[model samples]
Target: MKLPVLSLLVLVASCATPGGDAPATPAEMAAQARTALVHVEQPDPGSPLLQVDTAAIADSVDDAKARALLAPLLSQIADLSLARTHVSVASADWLLQCQSLRRLDVRACSRVDDAFVRAIVALPQLEELILARTATTDASIDALLASASLKRVWMWKSAVTPAGLARLAARDGLLVDAGLRPSDSSAEVEPKPEFVNLLPMPGEPALDAALVPINVNCPVTGAPVDAKRTRTVNGRVVGFCCNNCPKTFDADPAKYEAALPKP
Candidate 1:
């Protein structure tokens, strides 16, 4: 996704005029970036699986005007409630730019720890924080308590203990959701079917579907057909008197494929 070019134009226009405050922290840099985001005329980049970071722009542009101009394109940012994005301690600094942020979902993020929790606590406007299935523990729960605006915190499947929950319960206004729930989208996904080989532990039999049976019989053992012991190969059903016969037949089906009754 491209950064706001118009903001850059504005930065260029402001260059000849001189002095302004330089950003110090990631959040400060992100604040400068927000101005650019506001002026961006292009389409939304959408939630990209791989994020393009703005570190290079912040590093290369030593000019205060140029750095201020480019901050919005370089910092990792989300304007609204950032949900379901892969956030961890490493990239959590990106959220510093989202001054309007209210909700954050870092579920299933293995790297989420006290550092990430502390970083977000500084956001004065943050409200809902979802850390289900993440690695957060009691170490950062106190930091969360510091946010006067926070209303709800979801901590299911995290490292928090009952004691931690008890401590949070003392707070007057906060609501915590500690019940077990799936971490991703609300949709229920069905499990895929599994197949097992019938042969004994040592070998895998490669069966050929080309052989057509002439009669109903366990071609490998010459035994009468048993409906319970059947397998389909190449769209045709083959049966055997015992379950094991199918394995032997499968080992070298061509030897017996012609022996069964043909279609």
Candidate 2:
């Protein structure tokens, strides 16, 4: 009798667990994609790009059941930050729960649309929006204007056009493109086989991450290396859209590195 009681106590004590919710780790979230399915596939804090969507998983089963499975997964995404990694939202509900979304920054969200607007409308101080390459059009300009708390709107090279820009100009305290938005010097320049042309910009537009552009003269074509598509360093031949530049640069990286801007 004493042995049986002692054994029961050991099993229960071995199963002791933390009271708080177990924050899903990158590995556990990746596993969620396996059995549950998702619309978009992007990993965070765990691995490289897994561009599969949970919606695709739902669609495989049937259309009617798709939205149901998506609701819960999307709700879990309370805060979305796409710096070193990108994530797929199952739906808009996931973003809405972020009680303190003071700044809703969306960049390179090519699939975004009006459905996501209501999620951000309640954000009291949405001062900055960098919609560099998203699908949100001038039509959604209404949502931008309706946000009584909005200050700065950055739709650099997205759906906003010249006519659309004029329509948005009428907003009371908002700053639109041309003057309000930072101008892209790259757009003004003609692509050529020379150093990237510059026009009086005080400083370069901040790069996305730890990438330093190294422009080296092509040893083979003698044109700028933008055309050279491939390169190799430390005994590895890498490919590039601007090809031949690599062979020349790989020949001597120290020389090219000397010319490159310090990261």
Candidate 3:
């Protein structure tokens, strides 16, 4: 007996594979991901594995969508870029399953905190990590130190302090890009003056010309001091590079005090 067209189509679809239509091949999954604006690259034309890059569609991807798109391809993806996406710690947990991932970029992902760092560092094959502009702080650095395979980390604009960066830099065979090169850390390097004149605030007394600043450089920023911007702290005169530096110094005088030259 002849079947209706709709029924025939269903029968054909079921017969096409033992179960429902066979689960999508890695190549097919890659194509599907591309249709969603995710950039997918195969090692070669015929390779089933992929390199998923969501940077182009970062604004559109949230935690749920990230899971949906990456769950099936986790094993196949060697390099993944979720840079600037809205993914949080929830999505970061999925990365632990991605053992094949070699390089991962989460740059500018504000939700990537120490918790997220702790999660992804568990990825055994992760080699290069891009955490620049994220919320990861010094604690994240401590978490990353446990990773055996991580070789490089980019942390410019991150919450990591200079000390944290220094600790990470001390690791053997690990490269850190914190917006400063090895030469920039030299003790002999002189601080360049960013601003010269420091106008006094309304009703504030003018700076004393005869008074010398205890520190030749702005302790807070490591910039050349503006002679006109001076403040007396703990019976010592401190100088700053620009008008803003004084405010930063005021907020936490003790923190910057350590950089000042001692008597």
In terms of lDDT, the best-performing candidate is 3
TM-score of each: 0.40, 0.37, 0.60
Q: Model 3: runs farther than 4 Å from truth?
A: 1-22, 44-48, 182-263
Residue 103, candidate 2: alpha-carbon lDDT: 43
User: What is the Cα root-mean-square deviation between model 3 and the actual structure?
Assistant: 18.0
68: Cα error in model 2, Å:
17
RMSD of each: 14.3, 21.2, 18.0
Candidate structures ordered by TM-score, highest first: 3, 1, 2
Angstrom error at residue 110, model 2: 1.3
Count of backbone collisions within predicted model 3: 0
Ranking of models by lDDT: 3, 1, 2
Residue-level lDDT of model 3, residues 1-263, one tens digit each, is 22442353343334334465544576665665666667888865685556889876688677867876666577888889999899889987778888888899999899888889988899999999999999999989877889999999999999999999989999998999988756665567667854433456679887555476777789989988877778888888788889998888889878988998889
Steric clashes per prediction: 10, 24, 0
16 Cα displacement, candidate 2 (Å)? 19
